[model samples]
Target: MIIIAAVDDRNGMMFNHRRQSQDKVLREKILSLTAGKLLWMDHYSAKQFDGCTAPQLNIDDRFMWEAAPGEYCFVEDTSVAHFEKWAEQIILFKWNRKYPGDFCFDIDVQKPEWKLSHTEDFAGSSHEKITMEVYDHA
Candidate 1:
């Protein structure tokens, strides 16, 4: 039930300390949907998220979630459904500590990495393919 959001960098997604775009409707909807669940976020969103009773998960100590060697991670299925239904215009990304980069987390619930599909739709759906780049956070 946590409506997790990350800061979008032109290069990739990050969560150490980045501000969220101002969108009253999106904020309200996020608050409503995440009623009382834990809302994990980076340090940048603390002040903006004021009045939000839900707990904000800050991952400052850990830059990202590292997937096991040869393993991957992503958002949940229901979360994707919520995204497609509510925030279709938005793209989602999960923390990948291992690779240290943003990836297109596919919306396949069957895949264990299926948490939230990194929803990065290009200008056109005909784009051949997209690849993720891993950075050295260490």
Candidate 2:
């Protein structure tokens, strides 16, 4: 499975049980990237995409275990590092700023087994700029 997420400069994912920030451009980018593909996300994350046209599978806590290979998954409230063994690739959007956050992303993309395959910067509707990084399992 492929994992997609957004993180702050400090690799923070959320604070106060909610996302630290959001960008309309980033949401559109994710939708474009996952078009014609199955996107699996938890029920909470699903709410973020309300009225979206993409095919989404809303699962409970078992999303990680239930996701299949060749699928794309969007995660926010969970630590995705544990899925490394099952993940074929990981796409990360760096918010390029810090915000109040209690939840942190646990994956260390610096690991030798994960290769940084690509990176690009783009402006977001809410953020001035954001960096997108793609890592593939080596």
Best by TM-score: 2
lDDT, each prediction:
0.32, 0.86
Candidate 1 worst ten-residue window by lDDT = 70-79
Determine the backbone clash count of candidate 1: 5
Query: What's the distance in Å from true for residue 92, model 2?
Result: 0.4
lDDT of 1 by residue, 1-138 (tens): 222342233323322322323334444544554454444443444455666655523324221232222211123211233233222222233222232333323233333333443343222122222322222111
Tens digits of per-residue lDDT, candidate 2, 51-136, equal 87665555566677777887888889988877889999999999999888999888888899899999999999999899999999
Compute the lDDT for candidate 2. Answer: 0.86
